[model samples]
Target: MAPLRSRRRRALAVPVGLALTASLGFLPGSATAAAPQTADAPASAAEAGPELSYVVNTETGAGTVGKVKKAIAKAGGTVVTAHDRIGVIVVHSANPDFARTMRTAEGVQSAGATRTAPLKAAGTTEVGKPEKVREPRSAAALAAARASGQEPLESLQWDIAAIRADKAAEVNPGSRKVTVAVIDTGVDDTHPDLAPNFSAKQSANCVGGLADTGKGAWRPYTEDDYHGTHVAGEIAAARNNVGVAGVAPGVKVSSIKVSEAETSLFYAEAVVCAFMFAADQGIEVTNNSYYIDPWMFNCKDDPDQGAIVEAVSRAAKFAGRKGAIHVASAGNSSFDLAAKSLTDTSSPNDTTPVERTVDPSKCLDIPTQLPGVVTVSATGPKALKSYYSNYGLNQIDVAGPGGDKYQVPEAPAKDGRILSTMPGGDYAYLQGTSMAGPHVAGVAALIKSKRPDASPQEIQWLLKAHADNPGCPTEPYDPDGDGKVNAECTGTQHINSFYGFGIVDALDAVEK
Candidate 1:
């Protein structure tokens, strides 16, 4: 199966999300890098050689970064920025042995390069160009939609009504004080629907592992980077009699771009930067619609994967402690996350993928599977699992309206898909866990708006408490027209693999 993340909003036939497949030429075993040099090696070995990106994880404590700054510099690495709170430092170095030398430095826990390719490789490569084409809605449909207390294109948004967002808006349109940070590709703050409530102060680009707070830094600059803008609209599109309305139309939205311009790849240091930025900026909720790129499952036993898991886990846990409720997609590969053993062929995506059998419990899908994070599964308009949504009893915490073209929601929305703003001030219909995660994030924001003093844990409990639990279906599962069964739902109403705690309820979140 392809290891796509949840943001590849191209051909519906192609899976959304980061692809697990790798160009065979770059496979881990097939390729090699400069081995670590001895401490007594030539002085030139520690001098500047090739500028690379590295994530330096320091020993947890105050002054951890300061303690190792001299050592880092001696290794020919320059500190780009450091999250002293989490002990993660982003560095740029030309030394081939920067990571190796830094690892032996006092007060440094772990250090590794964030990508397989050099820092300059990303700029030269092109990836993740949007391929899907959406047709404009007929004038008659637009007119009829406006007549029914909806925006011109709102009639196509069954997702808004799926969670009863329209009713919730009547009761509570959310609060500007509560912000939902879109930690994805990038957001187009210029979109009319998003501009009204966009929080520029809270936005930044963490593309190269360091946060860039310049103007428009949070907006997508590459082709097909509208995924983040789409997610932002899903959470807090303006309620002004405009094109569409979000779940919490009044809540503020901020963009935190973590992916590269073309690849759409999210590296470990970049993720660490995003969480640290959100925590410091008082972002109440963060919507993580894509997985950390390259590896679908980061096994703790693997040194490289383990270091990434450790660094990102520290960042995520710190964000939670600082009061940001992280909501991430459960991925779109349809793999049962709770299974015992699974074969995964796509990994190290920047290079090549090698098929390997892994125990699901030992392999983790970061941020989503991390502790304290609310993992979300996707449901179509029919409230069934999206054909591509991955499910597991222990993995899913809630469900949301992730459109499925096969089983459309209700009338007024002819297509079975989620409609939201696109880049360049347009709109499109897209589906995936990428879409569903934002709905839950919006609802979380609404809950925060209602209870401003509520802690992240309290808001999490409220989300589960306010959800509408639909028991597992008794019928056999077969989403596609194929003759074979596709999935099996198990568990009770309160907790299940298919629907999780249950479909998120916006109305219940605000009123209950």
Candidate 2:
């Protein structure tokens, strides 16, 4: 619908962070790349060719891992890192057949290149930048905000009130013991609002299949890398009377930078590293705003794409087993994910996109459609499904305020987009399912704080239980009022395609 409006902003500027020359070894906390076992061979791994990154998933065990690494070495590939616990190995090689060769290793379950492009592939596309938000001009609202214990910029945030986060904070600001990880482009811990609650110890740069937890490793590479910072602000910006307060302001937040510096592409290698690092660190939650790149939808039937899905799914499953709950955006294409077949024109985003028809049932969006993730859809201030949000009867778990340009707020707040912290300590407006995922992550963090001992599955159950469903719209679901229907809402009033179990409620998370 409407040319598939997936707003994953990227720049045509000089690309950085794609040079994968890091020495081989498991990072202190993170291990190999995430999952799969086969692909036909084009050439032997020993033959020199363009450098590419690959993940080799194998049977878990020291013996199995050793045999796999030996196989990787014999195939003329360098071991970027090997995760013995999960049987995933991040390998780099100029050998054209590294992935195909590894698939034959005795203990290997799956193997495939993480990208169709070379090691230093650059993005050829560009997206519009986010708009910088100014202070609300109403003096009466400013005075009221100051008097009501709201932060300086809190008056500009209608999203907090939309999900009753403002009221939830008053009852309980949430426990700092719970930490949610923003697994995206880097985060700026220096922002005044985020600095206080940011957890440096848990943060790292998981770029190019390696995790670096050194001081400031988690900071954004450039001012334009603001997605993670905006996401962090939405989840746990401090309550101190500085800027806008977060939904769970008292909880701690960490950053696991997975996107390439300028291209802002999230390759599978980086994604796997981020998930493994977060889960190993005992992180309670992770917010995944973007899909695993190269492919928008990784089909399990295709050998290479299948391995990409398996790698990501394995890491996500491991995180769940390790007590980390993942919250991901339901996507912005506005397609019915439950539909039988859909046309996809964005596969292999790293080099060039090739159009292909795919079945939603088999061609899944990684991590988002992966089992055990709290898949969130976007909603506007009016408590309606956002025009850009993807929906399916049983796919969406909950809805959150991701903002909408059409759903303008009242006097105090002017912009309909979600207001959040940018890199250089500035505030801006960005609207997408990317923004929506953090809200769900924040609410889940609140649940973790209140229940302290609950498992990931239990926390997910609580989220669906406490949500306030707005059921499918009784009238034709057209926000623009155009004669043509923008999107059709399906399912019963209680749990439908658009609102999932309904909009998330922060107040009930603590009280219930």
Candidate 3:
């Protein structure tokens, strides 16, 4: 296993009060009363104005949330909802001039229309009937059969197939079932490939209002937001014909809608609630793909923020002790988590003051950064760092095929495609550390299925021990100045910020 490196000197501060609110409006009897009755119609009906979402940019400063709310009211607009973590406000207005006005509002950085539509309800549909497996197949035979196209599978990646085959050989196909909780925008419980694997009777929607209502329920949840479906497919989509195979095909999935959209803050309360529900149902693994920037947490010292972090940490730890594993995306910021600077050469072109260093003391991604959770980074087929993934000698625990944009000379076209389930009865091509997280989570499930006696820590150790080392011939200079890349480390012989323990090798992990 990769040695646990030095503590990151520049871990970012955790934010506070960025949690999502359960109710849309202030309580009727609350001291802070709702706005007085107005002649204007509701904001949703207002003429099509530019849709808007806010992003918080400062850790120590206040956001324009209140101002945005007030402006929405003054402009005859209604706030569909507000997310404190990312400091986003989803509002609708009839006036096309609203965006211009909002741009000038106090505390407002910027506002614009969301790329996706509002959430919708996905109806229940039977993609295929569940079948009982009488026996498990040998790993070698399964791999040979899949290679010969004898099984109905979706992923073209040989590694994924090999991993699944190994998992199938180790356990009783029916006795060892894994339950993966998906915490994202929302999932379409009705999609054919996904439907057979869902534990709907055991699932719940925590996005507010009646269960399964709001934009959260829409079919092909991908139309509005595909994050949840994509993650779910990676963990447990059925192996039957029609789509790609999940890492743990025999595992069951539970949908937990924590974020309404990608930028929205998934409330700490919602997360706790989801974990509690999963615990109650005996779910074995929980996968989180969304993250709020550091500034939204208001720094880790705030009482409220600290409490939320502690609660999440405790819950995840509890799940681990109970035999479940928690996995999360390390984030897409491309920052050197220990040095706290933009690690990606491409980051300069994406943000202001291109060369400005990212402060490590104020920038870690939640849940992933929290203790006890297994954080994962992204890698391509060639096993190189993905340009968009965040990395740190100690922050990231493992890497997986999250899909890199650059082409690989040996396997150019094979470099970046990840085949996973999508909404609307189709498959999709997604690329992110988000895609990488589930791959590890699914492997954890496979380990658990084979060795139900293995503890969470033991499973984590097993994964680390089997990781593929992507040896960098020479360590790059610590450009961001977090201290020279630990001189004690040689090439990729040991851990480095750019690539954690190395690329995930399913065949190696299962064999161990």
Candidate 4:
């Protein structure tokens, strides 16, 4: 099965003599196997089975809530919450037949369980184990940064410099009024670098498809699941002079935890709640660094996959309509999303995966392909496509520095992976389109901060209009230096698959 991007790290040659940290989560070119569940889910339920989560999608503009509620009840399911405006209903039921029965009910367009595992499934999957890295920076690097009035680790941030974020900060440090919601795993608000700018009121844990506003519930369980924290740090870590700074250091950030606590799976219902929460809270921008799990690509023709896509697509569009701009990663598989056909061996990741060839047009990568969403691809220090970043002639909307350890840029940036805050206030280097999406999001936040009255559509336009169009590489694209061609570039400097309009430009975003 193709491993999910979040769980994978880029392969790079470790500089000799660099001491390895003890907890290196996974090797440079490898991934840790998904942790096994603690116990097997019951094969069959007793008279009263454990409650399972389901999502019921109603036709748009249909005033069918009353009818849907009755149908849910008749199917032995209890309504958890209803996003009536978007026509999505979250439910819980012990009856295995709940989805099948609800499909026949009036006003219900499609209904399906959100997870393959039963609700009673126990145990947790340990994710984001720390990877090997050189020991903490020596006093020399710190002294150099301090002498230059930069953050302690700022010199290592080539990604920021690639888009001239350092220069943009001078133009406008951004405004506190703009909040970029990190809609992934969760954020560690207590990190010293993030504490000054974290927005608690706008944060929530939507792991079970319902909003959990309990105290501190929006934070990740631990750094082991540090994907969200890393993405958050990339967007809005404070310019506190202590740790590394973010692209838009002056903006506020909110944590909207959508991935399941143990499995790290981003289910459809959780994602639905996340977008809705961002909209209701008046968040101006949101960064989606991961795709919905179990199914890597959801085809519209398949009933189950169709429901998943329909429900989440409506929720994302609803967020856009409510004035929030959504930006997402283009995936890390390096496949051409605009291609006619591709092989997908890793899907239904929650269960056994089977190899299947899918038509990219019919099999949509939700949120990324959904209308009004800005799809971001990853570029390395040398301004080339990150070897693993997915691209397409028409799929990419923008490019950003996601780091390529093997394709290091120049002096000061010894490593190619993007560095950001981890759970315990520590920092780590990681790479993927997951790291690239936030660069655009942070730039989007800067745009919103500058034009506070602009609509989401207007902001999206400004984002593309103001980007720096660095055309595709003139030479054959090959980061590994192997003779074989990796991927081909098509289109002009204005538009292409590796980069949509162009690479995101922080300086242009905040400029008048």
Candidate 5:
């Protein structure tokens, strides 16, 4: 199965060294729950099963939430925390039937296990297999690039140049008032390119469903956890003439580390916390690069999946309601997310995955597929859709320079992937819609800086309005140049499957 885009990339290389990369407690009626026993109950409440996390959705009311909490306690679950604003309570349960029992309770809109795996255990994905540089730049070429009157490595950042971000910077380098939170693995804020504009106050470690704002709380916890750092650099790596420049170098960026340390799995609870934190922190935008874990597509027909959806959806909407625009990657699977049916074999990804054919209408990729979130596709240096970017008409809101393996960029960049800040104050080249999302997030930050009073919905519309749609190709898209057509394009030039409203125009975002 295609690995999710959180770190999706084929082996690529750069001249630089291959440096690839909470908690709430609800203290409620401790001893007793008034609810009755459940049929699907485990052998004994004393002998708890594998500990699991679940989300219990309910209507917003003190009486309703109180009764639901009582029911949860009775079902052998502990309230991890509750988002009173969204009426979503996070629960940890060792009882195998806890979700089943909670669903039968009054005032519970939905309930389900948040993951297939027990707490703390998660499946791992390799960062990427490093290979020889595809287009190695000569020493003279490197020197010439460094001579450019921008960040030392700015000349290597073709992705920035592709969207005219280099030009955009001179006009309005963005605003310190605007902050885009990287809601992914974690970001290395110490990187010289990112530190100057990093906003520690807005950053946190949201793993395990709680926000930890301790010093260095929001940093990559493991060696391979470099995705968020790369993403943050793409958005606002500071124009300090050190490393590569970001799309909106003047903007402030905060890291919201949500993915688990060992497994890199992005659980629903952590995702919800990140969104809620972003909303409460007054973040102008957030970049979500992965599908919620366990299920690539959360099918509402299923009880547990439905609860995960409701809980996360509520959090995302709450962020929007509070004026935070969320920009999410369209995924790296290359599946047409708007199609009738799609295959998801790597779902329940924290455990053994079961292959299933799912309808796009029902099963949704969280955050990205949610309403009011700007869904982004990726493009190559040539402005063609990246080979691995997921796309669809109406489903995608914009496209960005995500890099393409088949469409190699020129020297200095020296690879078909993107270059951004990595952990350890270094930089590396990687690619995915994961990379694309941040570019758009940077543009959205620029928009937020320009139109500070605009709402999330308005900024989203403006993103499309300023996008430069390449128009649907008359012929089938074959970016890889194989005999077979890779993916078909749909919709009109103004709005299509391949390029969305077209590549996001950062220059116009500031100039317009």
Candidate 6:
């Protein structure tokens, strides 16, 4: 799927612009002057209301957090949340001068007015097939299959019979109930195969001012992106004939639309609201397939940028704390996340070379980059890295089958081979890291269903420990270095960047 761009029109201010410049290693004092704030004079203190957050300098060390908090309190601003890593202080105040006052305060770095609102429901986008209701496959057939005790299937493509056979021995298919939230465009609650698994409550579109589809109020009425529907099917398509089965056949799915064919800003409020809804609905697992690229250079870690991350992180943490697991796509952009410099770091002697820096005007990658969220990368059925799938050893937790037909070095014969659900019909072949994310998500739901007591971290560790390492070279494509692959470029016994922990092993995860 093509990436959605940001639609925010307002230009950033001085501190923010300066921060972006500094992040790119540009001289701090060399930044261009920012445009005037607003034409109208500052609103009265009462009209301005209280400030909600204070943006801080990324250069400020950790020690500055307490000092900044003290200052906020002295200003009668109640600190609601503090993001130390990104230097942001979420507060409750309507003060219009909050940004100006905090910018001048010692250790304050920068301050800006922040807004927080309740996440609203999203409207239905595309309407596909209705949900499906099915009778349990023969218990006798399942018993006999288990009695044979044959080895589990090994093909990368999803096999329903195989999953059922393997899980039948230990899992009571009826007893394992899991709710997976598809936080993407939307789902076709009417799809025959998906109907049985969808929540009776119609899905919600969080986009504001959108038409109210029967699914939810205020959801935008738009063309079916088919993104979320495909994802939903991959996680819980019923075991009926006419299509492939999901990793977890019996799990339930809840659709939450947070994106459109338009822009990311159109869905920003929707995204935040989706997270809040997921937490309140007791939905255990959420699959986020969308993301915003990093903003301006130094602005990668700017408070505004970090605010979204922190908010998402808090929501994920809340879900985790509530026994839910959040899974997101690592992204399709291939870059060494650890090696990329978002800010200028002063070497011991301030002599280290500074190369390309990320743009801070862009919003940092979402859901995947958010803390406490399990970021997943894509791998072909052959266990090779999908050319389009992004990789960051530290960021991506695992890999799964996301058919990659559009990468460099002509896509292999199996290029367009992702096993997922398609609208208007049952399961079909599709490809992308978007396809890969749900495979892991379905497996996660299965794990949670089978081991209800396991913590989110424990489940993550279990999945990682059981992954099958796809031995891809460690030295990323060296365009200029000697063509030969070096020894250090080889795979080790454990985790590596190309394939974090390795391709997810369903059998091992379920058994472990």
Best candidate (score: lDDT):
5
Cα misplacement distance, residue 56 of candidate 2 (Å): 0.6
TM-score of each: 0.89, 0.90, 0.62, 0.89, 0.90, 0.64
lDDT of 6 by residue, 59-162 (tens): 33667888777666655456655545445555554444444445555776445432221122111111112222121335664554345542111122333322
The order of the candidates by TM-score, greatest first, is 5, 2, 1, 4, 6, 3
What is candidate 1's CA lDDT for residue 75?
71
Clashes of 1: 9
Cα lDDT for residue 350, candidate 2: 62
Put down candidate 1 lDDT per residue, 1-512, tens digits, no spaces. Answer: 12243323211212122110101222221123655544345226444355667778897676667878878877777898888877888888766676767778889887776666666665101112223324355688667766777776676678888899989998998998999999977899988999999999999999877889999999997535777887898899997766789999999999999888666678888889999999999999999877776777777665456667888999999989999999988877777888897776766666666777777777888878898999888888888888888889868999888777678556756667677777877676667787788899999999999999999999988988888877687777778757777888888989899878999999999998
lDDT of 4 at 60: 51
Each model's lDDT comes to: 0.77, 0.78, 0.52, 0.76, 0.79, 0.51
Error of 1 at 277 (Å): 1.1
The residue-by-residue lDDT of candidate 2 on 273-390, one tens digit each, is: 9989998899999988887876778778666677778888888888889999999888877778999998877666666677778898889987789999998888887888877778
For all predictions, the C-alpha RMSD in Å is: 5.0, 7.3, 13.2, 7.1, 5.6, 11.9
> Per-residue lDDT for 329 in model 4?
84
lDDT (tens digit, per residue) of candidate 5 on 249-291: 9999999988886777788999999999999999999988777
What is the TM-score (0 to 1) of candidate 4? 0.89
lDDT of 2: 0.78
Instruction: List pairs with backbone clashes in candidate 2.
Output: 32-83, 34-311, 35-311, 36-110, 37-109, 37-110, 294-348, 469-502
Q: How close is candidate 2 to the true structure, as a TM-score?
A: 0.90
Give the CA lDDT, 0 to 100, for residue 470 in model 1.
Answer: 76
Q: What would the per-residue lDDT of candidate 3 be over residues 26-65, giving only the tens digit for each residue?
A: 1111111323323233334433433322221111123456
